[model samples]
Target chain A: MKPRIAFFDFACCEGCQLQVANLGEALLDVLKLVDVVEFREVMSEKWAGPLDIAVVEGSITTKEAVERIEKIRARSRILIAYGSCATIGGVNGMKNRSPLEEIRRTVYGEHAHTFPTIATRPVDQVVKVDYYVHGCPIWPPEFIEVLQAALQGVPCFPPDHAVCVECKLNENVCLYDKGVTCLGPVTRAGCNSWCTNNGNICYGCRGLVSNPNTKGAMDVLARYRIPLELVLNKMSMYNACREQGKTP
Target chain B: MRYVTIPADKMADYITALARRQKVVAPVEKGKGQFAFEPISEGREATLTYIPTILPPKKFFMPQYETLLEYDLHEGQKMQAVVELEEMVLFGVHTCDLAGIACLNTVFSDRPKDLNYLIRKNKIVIIGLECVAYCDEYASCALMNNHLPNGGYDLFLTPLGDRYIGHVNTYIGDSLVEEGGFFRDATGADFAALEEVRRRKREVFHDEVPIDLDEIPRIFAHSLRTTIWKEIGDRCLSCGNCTNVCPTCYCFDIVDKPNLDLKSGRRIRVWDSCQNERFAKIAGGESFRKERSSRKRHRFFRKFRYPVDRFGKFFCTGCGRCSRTCMARINLKETLAQLAREYV
Candidate 1:
C-alpha cells in the first residue's frame, strides 16, 4: 500500500509549501507514490486519520502551534521537520532576541493587548522528528529522496560533512582565497555549494554540520583579522536551536 | 625506468595516436599562462610545461554540473539514478593538482561511497607531470608536502634533458608504453638527470610560512579571541572569491528545478559559499553566523583546525588561490603570520 503523507504549517513564510508546488511534475509523481491526504497548499481536501508520514513545516511561535504539533505527532508514525523553519527555528527564531511582550508591543502597538506570542522553536524542540529536510525552502530533491527512503523502510540522514568537500570537487576557488571569509568549512554538506558556483558566498541555510567546531571557525577568522563581534553574530544566527539562552 | 625520446616532429603523431586509441585530454594554452584541459588531437596544442590549470583535472572525475538522477512526473514520479561519465586519459597533470585529486579519492572512496564520483574516476587514467619548481607565488605546495610527486598517477613523467623519464606506475601505463612505440630503456645517465632535477627543486621551493605544520592547530586554538577576525571581516565584502578559488572549500546547496510542465525536475547540487549573509539564516529569520567576522573566522578554522581534527590533515593545500583572488586583500599568509605572532 502507498504510504500516507501529510503537510502541516505553523509560523512560516509558507515558502516551503510553495517550494513543494515548484516541484511541478515531481509533485504529481510524489502524490502517486504516496497518499498526500493533507497538504493545505495544493488541495482543499482534508482527512482526519493516522498518517504514515507527517511533514511539518514552519516553527512553533504560539501556544496553538504547540498543541497542534502534539496532535500531529500522536497521529503520525513518522514526523519530518521540513525546511529550515521546521528543523532549526529558521529566521523567525530571530525574534527570540527580544522578550515576547516587547516583540508584541513593537509590532502590534495598540493591538498588543490581544496578540499572543512565544519564543520561536523548530518542531524538533517540542516533538520528536523522525527526519529533517533542511534548507530555507527545503530542496525538493531531498524531500523526494527522503520520501523514497521512507517507502523503502531505509532511514535517510543528512550528510555530516562540510561544504568545502563539494566546493573542491566543483573546482571553484575558495572565497577566503579571494580575500573574503566563508563558512563552508563548518556548514553541512548536501546543498552542493550552490551559491558558491554562481560567484556568491554560502549563507549556511542548511545549518551547521554535526559537531561543528564553531570556536575553531572563529579562530580562523581572527587569523584573517576579522572582528570577534562580527564572527559571534554570524554564528548566533539560526543557532538559537543550539544556543537557547547563551550569549557569544 | 624507461626513457622516451619523441622528437618535436613526431609528437603530434604520438598524441593523435593516443587520442584515437583512448580518450586523451591535455592542457591547452588559453592565453597568458592560463591553461585548460581539452581534448587534444595533436601534440602542438598541448602545453607540456605549464602551471596548474585554472580548474584542476578534478572536473573530469566530478563534472561541475553532472546529473546524478533524472525524474519524470508524468507517470507516478518515476526516477532513474544516472551518472554521466567519459573514459579518458588526463595527461600532463601537475604534482600539486595530482595531490589534490588524491585528496578527492580519499574523500569519495570513504564509507557511503559516492558511486557517481567513484565510477567516473575509475574510467579515467592519470598521467602526472613533475613540476621542477613553483608554478607561481600562489603555490605553497612545498609547505603542504605536495610539491613533489606522491604517486597518485598511473604514469609519472619527469623531464630529463632532451628526453623524458617515464615511470610506468600501473598495468595500463605499461600497456600504453608497449603500444606507443616511442619508449627506450632508461640509462644510468637518465636516472642521474632525474635526480639532479629533484635536488634543484628542493633548493627552489622553500617554506612560504615560517610556522611549523604541527603548530597550526595549536596557534588557531590559542588565538580564538584575537582581533584579527574583526579587521578582515570589516574589509571583506563576503563575495566568496576565497572559497571559490580554494582547492578544498566544498560547501554546496541542493535545489530542485522543475520543467515548465511541472511534472518532472532534476535535483541539482550547486556550489555554495558561507560568506553570503543568508547562508546560515533559517526561514524563521534566525541566523547562525550573522556577522562577517564570524563567517570569516569559520572559513579559516575549516582549513587549519577543523579538517586537521576530522581528516587528520590540513585541508588547505597551501594553494594561495584564496589570497590571490580575494577582493578585500585578505592575505592568507599574512593572517597565519599574525595568528602565529599573537598565539605562539
Candidate 2:
C-alpha cells in the first residue's frame, strides 16, 4: 500500500511548497512513490484522515497554528519538518528580538487588538517531528531522498557534519584563505555548500551542526581578520530558534 | 636494474609517443611563473619545474561543475546517471598536488562512495614529478610531510642530471615502460642518484614555519577564545576566495538546471564554499554561523583540528594556495604563529 503523505504550512512564505513544485518531473516521481493525499499547494482534494507521513512547513506564531499542528501530529504516524522555518524557527523567529506585545503593536497599532500573536517557533516545538528536511527553500534532492527513505521504512535524519567536509571535496579555495569569512564549519551539511559553489559564502541556512565547535569557527574568522560583532550579527540571522530557546 | 640515459634532446619523442598512445596532460606555462595542467602533445609544452598550478589536479577527479544525473520530463521522470570521463596520463604533477590527490581519494572512496568521482578517477593515470626545492615562500610541504613522493601516483620521476629517474609503482606503469621503450630498469647507481636527490631535498625543504605540526591542533584548541578571530574577521570581506583555492576544500552544492522546455534537466554538483553568507541559511531563514569570526574559525578548525580528530590527519596539506589567493593578505604562517603564541 502506498504511504499516505500530507503537507502542512504555518506562518511562512510558503516558499518550501513552491520549492517542492520546483522539483518538476521529480515531483511526479515522488507522487508515484507515495500517495500525497493532502498537499494544499498541488491537490484540490483534501483527505481529513490519518496519514503515514506529514511534511509540515513554516513556524508556529498563533494559537491556531499550535492547535492545528497538534491535530496533524495526532493523525500522522511520522512528522517531517519540511524547511528551516518548520524545523529551526527560521527567520520568523527574528521577532523574538522584541516582546510579543510590542511586535504586535508595531505591526498593527490599533488593529493589534483584533489579531492574535505569539513568538514564532518551529513545528517541532509543539509536536514530535520524526524527521527534518532542512534549508531555506528545501533542497529538492534531499527532500526526495528523505521521502524515499521514509517510504522504505528507514529513519531519515539531516546530516550532522559541517559544510567544510563538502567544500573540501569540491576543492574550491577557502573563502577565508581569500581573506573572506565563511560559516562552513558550523553550518550543517546537506545543502552541499550551495552558496559557496556559486562564489558566495555560507550563510548557515541548513542550521548548526550538532555539537559545532562554535569557538573554533570564531577563531578562524578572527585569524582571517573579520570583525567580531559583524560575525555575531550574521550568525543571529537564521539562528533565532536556538537563540530564543524555542528549539525542541 | 640499470641506470639508462635518454638525453634531453629526445624528450619530445617520448612525450609525443605517450600522447599518441593515450591522452597526456602536463603543466604548461600560463604566464609569469604561473602554470596550469593542459593537454600536451609534445614535451616542450611541459613545465617540469613549476609552482603549484592555479588549480590543483583535483579538478581532474572532481570538476568544478559536473553532472551527476540527467533527467527527462518528457518520459515520466526518466533519469540516467552519467559520468563524463577521459583516460589521460597526468604528467608533471608535483609532490604536493599528489598528496592533495591522495586526500581526495580518501574522501570520495569513503562509504556511500561518489560513483561520479570514482569512475572519473579510474580513467586518469597519475605520473608524479619530484620537487627538488621550495616552490615558493608559501609552501610548507616539509611541515605537512608532503614534500616527498608519498605513493599516490603510478609513476614518480626525479630529474637526474640529463635524464629522469622513474619509479614505476604499479603494473600499469610497468606496462607503459614495456610499451614506450623510453624507460629502462634502475640499477644500484640510479638508486644512489635518487638517494642523493632526497638528501639535497632535505636541505632545500626545511619547515617554512617554526610551529610543530603535532601541536597545531592543540594550539588551535586552546586559542579558540583568543582575539585572533576578531582581528581576522574585521578584515574578512566574506569573499570566499580562501576556500575556493584550498587544495583540500571540497564543499559542494547540488542543483537541477531545467531546460527552456521545462521538460528536461540535469542534476549538477558544483563547487561550493563555506565562506558565503547564505551557505547555512535554511528555509524560514535560520543561519547557524552568521558571524564572520565564527565562519573563519570554522575554516581553521576544519583544516587543523577537526580533520585530525576525524581522519587522523591534518586536512591543510600546506599547499599555500589559501594564503597565496587571499585578497585580505591573510598569512597562514602568521596566523599559526599568533595561535601558538596565544596558546603557549
Candidate 3:
C-alpha cells in the first residue's frame, strides 16, 4: 500500500507548503509513491486518518498551534519539520526577543485581550520531528529527495556542512570580500547557495551546523573588522532558537 | 617561429581573430575590484592584465555542474553516457592556475581516468599570461614554484616594452601565431629583453611563508594533533570556503535530476568540500572526521601531505583563492608559518 502523506501549516505564509504544488511535472512521480491525504493549501478534501508521513510547516506561535502540532505528532508515523520556520522557528522566532504581549497588542489591538499567544518555537520543541526540510521556502529538490527517502523507509538528513560549501561549488565571488556579511560558515548547507548565486549574501535560513564554532565565527568577523553586533543580528535572524538555547 | 611578437596595439586583433574562429573566454571586470571569466564576442572585452578571476579556469575544465549521463526510465533503464564539448581559446591564464590544472590532470588521468574532463580539456586552447608583480599579498606562487611559466600552457606571453612576446610552446600555439598575421618573428634582442624581465621578476616574488618547500610534508606529519588545527578550527565556520576556493581541491558529489514525468533524468557531478562535517560520513552515521579541528587538519594535510606522497608534489599552487575567499579570515600563508614554527 502507498504511504499516506499530509502537509500542515501554522503561523507562516505557507510558501513551503506551496512548494509541493510548484513541483510541476515531478508531482506526478510523487503521486505514484504515496497518497497525499490532506494538504489544505492545494486541495479541499480534509480526510483525517492514521497518516504515514506528516510534513509540518511554520512555527508554534500560538497556544492553538501547539495543540495542533501535538496532535500531528501523535497521528503520523514520521513527522517532518518543513522549511526554516518549522525546523528552527525562523523569522517568527525574532518575536521571542520582544514580549509576546507587546506583539499581540501591536497586531490584534483591542482583540489582544482575548487571543492567547506564546513565545515562538519550532515544531520539535512541542513534538518529536523525525526529519527536516530546511530553507526559507524549502529548496524543491531536497523536498522531493526527502519525500522519496521517507517513502522507501530510508532515513535521510541534510548535509552537515555550511552554506559556504555550496557557494564555493557554484563558483561565486565571496560576499565577505565584497564587504557583505553572511552566515554561511556556521549555517547548514542544502539550498545549493541559491541566495549567494543570485547576487546576495547567505541569510542562513537553514539553521546552524552541528558543532558550530560560534567563537570562531565571531573571531572571523573581528578579523574582517566587521562589528560584532552585525553578526549577532545575522545569527538572530534565522538561528534565534539556538541563541535562546545558548543562554537558557 | 618558436618566439613571436605582437605590437601592443595588435593585441585586440589577435583576440578578434581567435573569437572569429571559436569562442574566446578571458577575464572581464565584474564590479569594483572583482573579475570573472566570460566569453567575449570582441577582443577588447578581454582583460589580460587583471588579478586572478573570482573563479579559476577550472570552471571550464570541470564545471561546477557537469552532466555525465542521461537516463530514461520509460524503457528498461535506457541510458547513455554523454560528454558536453565546445571549442574555445582560454586567454590570460595565470601560472598558478596552470599548475592547478596540471594537478587536476594528474588526478583525472590516473588509472581510473575521467574521460569527460580529459576530452573537454583538449578542446580548449590555453594561453598563459605572466604576472610581473604580485597580484596581491594573498598569492604565494613563489613558494609553490609556479612563479615561472610551467609547460601546461601552449602559449606563454610576456610583457615587453612596445610589444608582447609570445612563446609558441606547442604546434597549436604556432598555428595561432601564423593565423593571426599580426605577429613578427622575435628577434634575438627580443629574447634578451624576455630574459631580463624574468630575472627581475625573481627578485620581486619570493617565498611568502617561512617554511621550505621540502619540509611541508614533514611538518604536516608532525603537526597531526597540534593545537594549531584546534585554533584554526575554532575560528572556522566549517563553511568549506577554504576548500572550495582551493584550485587543486577537486572532490565532488554526484546528483540526479528527473524530468517532471519522472520518465527521464540526467546525472551530474558538483564540487564537494572535505572541510564539510559530513564529507566522510557513512551510511551508519559513523563520521571519521566528526570534529571541526580534525576536518581542518584533513584539508591542510590533503594539500601538503597526501598529494605530495601520491603525486610526488604539493597540490597547492599558491593561488591564494582559498585565503582571499575565506569568510573566517583564515589566511593560508599565516597558517603555514605557524605550523612551521611548531614543527621546527
Candidate 4:
C-alpha cells in the first residue's frame, strides 16, 4: 500500500507549503510515490486516520497549537518537522528574544488579554520528530530526497558538514574575501549554500548544525569586529530554541 | 624540457592560437574585482595577474559534485561504476595551485586510487602562470615552498620585460608551443632576465609567517594540547570555510539520489569537512571529535603534520584562500606565527 502522507501548518506564512507547490514538474514525480491524504495548503478534503508520515510546519506558538500537534503525533507513525519553524522555531522564535508580555502587547495591542501566547518551540518540544526538513522555507531538494528515502527505506539526513562545503563546490569567492562576514562555516549544509552563491552572507536561517561550535562562531565574528550582541541577535532568529538545549 | 618565448605584443595571438589548438580554459574577470577559471577565446579576456580564485583548479580535476555509481534497486541493488571527464587546456594557473594539484594527485593516486579523479585529471592539460611577486598579504607561499614552480604543469609561463617565457616540461607542452607558430627558441638574454627576476623575487616574497618550514610538523606534534586550539575553537563558527577554500583539503561524503521511478538512482560524492560535528561520528551516536577546537586541530594537522608523514610533503600549498575566505578572520599566517611562538 502507498504510504499516507499529510502536511500540517500551525503559525507560519505557509511559504514552506508553497515550496512544495514550487517543485513544478517534480511534484508529479512526488505524487507517484505517496498518497497525500491531508495538506490544507493544497487539498480541501482532510484525511482523518492513521498516517504513515505527518509533515508538520511552523512553531508551537500557542496553547491550541500544542494541543493540535499532540493529536498529530498520536495518529502518525512518523512525524517529520518541516521547514525552519517546525525544525528550529525559525523567525517565529524571534519573539522569544523579548519578554512574553512585551511580545503580546506589541502584536495584540490592547486585545493581548483575549489571545494566548507561549514561548515558541519546534515540534520535537511537544512530540517526537522522526526527521526534519529544515530551512526558512523548506528546501525542495531536501524535501524530495527525504520523501524518496522514506519510501525506499533508506536512511535520509542532511550532511553533517557546514554550508561552506557547497559554497566551495560552487567555487564562489568567499564573502570574507570581499569583506563581507558570512555564517556559512557553522550553518548546516542542506540548503546547498544558496545565499552565499547569490552573493549574500549566510544568515543561518536553516539553523545550526547538529553539534554547533557556538564558541567557534563567536571567535569568527569577533575577528571581523562584529559586536557580540549583533551575532547573538542574528543567532536568536533560528537558534533561540536550539541554543536553550532543545531538539526537533 | 625546453624554454621558448611568446612575444609580449603577440600574447593575444598566442592565446587565440591556443584556443584553435584545443579547448582553452583560463582565468577571466568575474566583475567587481572577482575572477574565475572560464573558457577564453582571446588573451585580453584572461586575467593572468589576479588574486586567487574562489575555488582552486581542483574543480576541473574533481568537480564539486561527481557521480560515482548508478544503481537499480529493482534488481536487488545492481550498480554500475561511472566517471565523467572532458578535454580542455587550463591556462594561467598560479604556482601555488600547481603544487596543490600535485598534492591531490599524490593522495588520490595512492594505493586504493581514486579512479574518478585520476580519469578526469588525465583528460585536461595544465599550463601554469608565474606569480612575479606575492598575490596579496594573505599568502604564505614562501613558508610552504610553493612560491616557485615545482613541475606540476605541462607548461609554465613566466612574464619577462617585453616577452613571456614558456618552460615546456612535457612533450605535449613542446608540441603546443612548436605548433602554435607564435613561440620561438628563447635566447641567452632571456635566461639572464629570468634569473634576474627570480633573484629579486627572493627579497619580495619573504616568509609571510615567522615559523620555519622544517619545524612545522614538529611544532604541530608538540602542541597537540595547546590552549590555542581552545581559543580558536571558542571563536570558530565551525562554518568549514577554511577547508573549502583550502587547495589540499579533500574530504568528501557520498549520497544517492533516486530518479522519478524511485527504482534507479545515482550515487554522488560531495565535499565534506572535518570541522563538522558528524565527520567523526560513528554508528553508536558517539562523535569522537565533539569539540570545535578538536575539529580545527584535525584540519591544521591534516595540512601541516599528517600529510607530511604520510605523503612526504606538506598538503598546504600556501594559497592563502582559507584565511582570505574566513568570515571569522582566522588568519592562517597569524595562527602559524602563534604556533611558532608557543613552541619555538
- Best-to-worst order by lDDT is 3, 4, 2, 1
Complex DockQ per candidate: 0.04, 0.03, 0.55, 0.58
For model 4, the TM-score of its B chain against the native B chain is 0.96
lDDT of 3 by residue, B188-300 (tens): 99999999999999999896998789888788889988899888777777777777667788899998766544568799998887877778888887999887788888888
Worst 10 residues of 4 chain B by lDDT: B232-241
Docking class of 2: incorrect
Judging by lDDT, tell me the better candidate of 3 and 4.
3
lDDT (Cα, tens digit) per residue for candidate 4, span B219-331 = 98888999999877776777676887678888988877789789898999877788776788899888899887888888889998899889899999999988877666778
lDDT of 2 by residue, B195-273 (tens): 9989988988876787888888788779778889888876565546577667788788897765433467789987766
Model 4 chain A weakest 10-residue run by lDDT: A239-248
Model 1 C-alpha lDDT per residue in residues A124-201, reported as the tens digit of each score? 888988888888768777787777666656677776556765665555656765666666766776676777877887
Question: Residue A40 deviation, candidate 4, in Å?
Answer: 2.4
Candidate 2 lDDT by residue in tens digits, A51-130: 99999999999999889999999999988898888889888878887888899999999999899888888877788888
True contacts kept of 3: 0.78
- TM-scores, one per candidate: 0.60, 0.63, 0.91, 0.92
DockQ winner: 4
